[model samples]
Target: MTRDTQGENAPSDLDLTRLLQTLTVESDRYAERFGSRHGLHRTDVNALALILAAARRGEPMSPSALARELGLSPSATTALIDRLEAVGHVERERPSGDRRRVALHVPEAGLEEGRKMFVPLAEAFADSWAGFGPAEREVVARFLDVSTEAMKAVSAEWAPPHESQRRR
Candidate 1:
């Protein structure tokens, strides 16, 4: 086998790292295209995804939580939320139980639009994984979970404290 730049064997950890990097770049490119098509910034698209995911998990996000997740300032997050709300893509609801707390939600139209945009990608992922058996899939899932944790840890380590935290 050919040696890599560090004199390591081909198809080693370095190869896997490069593959993951490529996957990230491609995913970002896809998101960029989607943002462009929908008249949104990349950050806006990311916020929408986070809000949608939180809603799906039955734990809706707040502006502050979104700011932390996006590493954005509280003001910037508010601006983003405003833009999304103006576009009818998101809404801020004050739950009846806690009138002071604001919950972010994607309107039904927004959900439908997102579903239309993502269904093709979801199908592609399913098709790609079709050849993998249960054992292989389990290993893949474990790898993904570990990789996600590692990334999150690194992000947390390097990220500066959010502006909201600075005020408190």
Candidate 2:
């Protein structure tokens, strides 16, 4: 296999790829445990995370947007939203002038719940990288940003068109 090598001591592309895969598996395992403890499915946890992130960015997501992000069918997305709503983790609101435009929100309680579940993990991550200097942290951050974009591009290319797309 063709490999991109930086130096004799530096990790090759294959090594980096394998490391990323391992990291993903470990991260998923953590999510699974959190989901179990919270009585949520892994998908539910993922959905909540997306919603929370969007809210933080001042761009609350609609159900359709969440469905696209999750690669879930409309019906399945609705069901997932219903489950979250039942558990008091999500709320649907019509905050726009157009009454039909519904936005997903994580209530204050839900936000606190998420913080309680994840802040320690975030702290642990921060602690792990505490030794890295400014330049090293910049390089690491750039690598992650590029890697995320590349993964998203590949996922978009491989994913089948959602129902909304197909209808257009």
**Tens digits of per-residue lDDT for model 1, 1-168:** 334677655566666677788999999999898888888999999999899889879997999999878888888999999999988899999989998999999999988888888899999999999999999999989988998898888876776755346646
User: Which regions in candidate 2 have their CA more than 4 angstroms from the true location?
Assistant: 1-7, 161-168
Cα lDDT of model 2 by residue, 71-168, tens digit? 89889999999999998899999986889888999888887887887899999999999999999999999998998898888876777756447547
lDDT of 1: 0.87
Query: lDDT at 152 for candidate 1?
Result: 83
Q: Candidate 1 — worst ten consecutive residues by lDDT sum?
A: 159-168
Q: What do the candidate models score in CA lDDT, each in turn?
A: 0.87, 0.87
Model 1, 56: alpha-carbon shift in Å? 2.1
Distance from true position, residue 68, model 1, in Å? 1.4
> Which residue pairs in candidate 1 have backbone atoms (N, alpha carbon, C) closer than 3 angstroms, thus clashing?
none
Weakest 10 consecutive residues of candidate 2 by summed lDDT? 1-10
